[model samples]
Target: MSDDQSPEPQIFETLQPADLASRVADQVLRAIGDGRLRPGEKVADARLARELGTSRAPVREGLRLLESQGLIVSHPRRGFFVHAYDADELKEVYDLRECLELHAAEAAVARMTKADCARLEAQVQKLYDLADEGQTQEQVVQDFAFHRMLCELGGNSRILRLFDQIAAELRAGIALVGQLYDDPEEIARSHDPLIKALRARDPARLRAELHEHLQDAQIHVVQLFRTGAFDLTNLDKLSDDQRNRLLR
Candidate 1:
């Protein structure tokens, strides 16, 4: 190698105004998680623009981003609406989730460091803390983060990407449908089994624990959809405080 060889010049394209779109998209997700937005509700981008203090273009783009992720849907002339989930749609998502995470858990146990296991333990403990406080929304976010780590630790780029693609819908679903149990600790403590399996470095146990956990969630979420629990909730009310709290 020639030390004096000229290096290729870095070419950078002008960045698009995607940050605003992403910010708007994040606020929309927060609102959905907060129960300010729900299934089958119209998403008025104009109102969101005023709430976000921007033009409608970015708001529309943001909703489009979510639509790509299956959280929002567009109608012919009626603007956008929150995607109304049913049992069948949920079944597909959960089935895919099981297929991915079970294998990911097996791979994770094979490659995870002690520090990695410790990090997982800390996250699980945080779930207990959040559950104790009865912060359902925060618990939903934390729960998603905990399971998302499985794919991250698994060290498979494709699996991680796929998980991310479905993540927006997954997070929204968890937030909207909520837990089946009145006892938050039940769901929080359920993760303990996964940690135990991981600590032992037993792939079979890890997969079994993860499978059962996901299966339980699948059953719970599908039942919620079947019973139309979320159909009547959060029809239309984007409060200033909710938007500000979410966006800011």
Candidate 2:
């Protein structure tokens, strides 16, 4: 076609109200989880509205929802700040993750269809591949993906929602602990039995394996605590170095 006869470019339309709200909230939550928005970082509604290209009304509504979910806190005059990163709070987050994730594992064993097992197997294989490749970042991502898939297979929205909320807080501590260890392989080994139990569809074995997984998670966090690395300020700062190392 001649230049003058070229087709016009397509233009995307606006997001649905529900989609817009969810997208805004997800962006903000991801920022907080990734340390881009550190604990105590002020969350200004006007700034959020501007950044998201939406009105302050929806931003305020999003903030209110996040606050109620315990992800953000609004001070009388200081506006909203990221919360739930204190040492004790991290402990609580991990504990809750353990409870829900263990149950999810059990449920998954009971409810796993062939297709669900296939997906779980695929995620498990990815974890193994990432481990073999020696890509620590990809290994961590796949590791979490395996667990997330298991939760999905559990067929329980209530449990999945609870796991989703706690995963970020749990990840903060895990990322913090990364600096003090060099044993991603050792960590990756934990997934084998969990996958095996799922393949067998044995809830008892799945529950046991999950308990062991969470125990190890707890131990890893405790090690970070002992190293004085899990402190909120230390975690936030060390994360900069961690990101740089991963990039290299």
TM-score of 1: 0.69
Q: How high is the lDDT of residue 165 in model 2?
A: 75
- Using lDDT as the measure, which candidate wins? 1
Off by over 4 Å in 2: 1-23, 177-181, 225-227, 230-248
Candidate 1 per-residue lDDT, tens place, 1-248, comes to 58999864422122245588888887787666545676789988767776667788888988999998888999998999998777788789889988998888899999999999999999999989988898665666677778889888999989988887666455435554345778887767889999999999999988888888988888877777678775443322324443233222
Q: Count clashing pairs, candidate 1.
A: 0
Clashing pairs in 1: none
For model 2, what is the error of residue 122's alpha carbon versus the real structure, in angstroms, after optimal superposition? 3.5
lDDT of each: 0.75, 0.69
- After superposition, which runs of candidate 1 have C-alpha atoms over 4 Å from their true positions? 1-36, 45-65, 129-140, 176-178, 230-248
Clashes of each: 0, 0
The candidate maximizing TM-score is 2
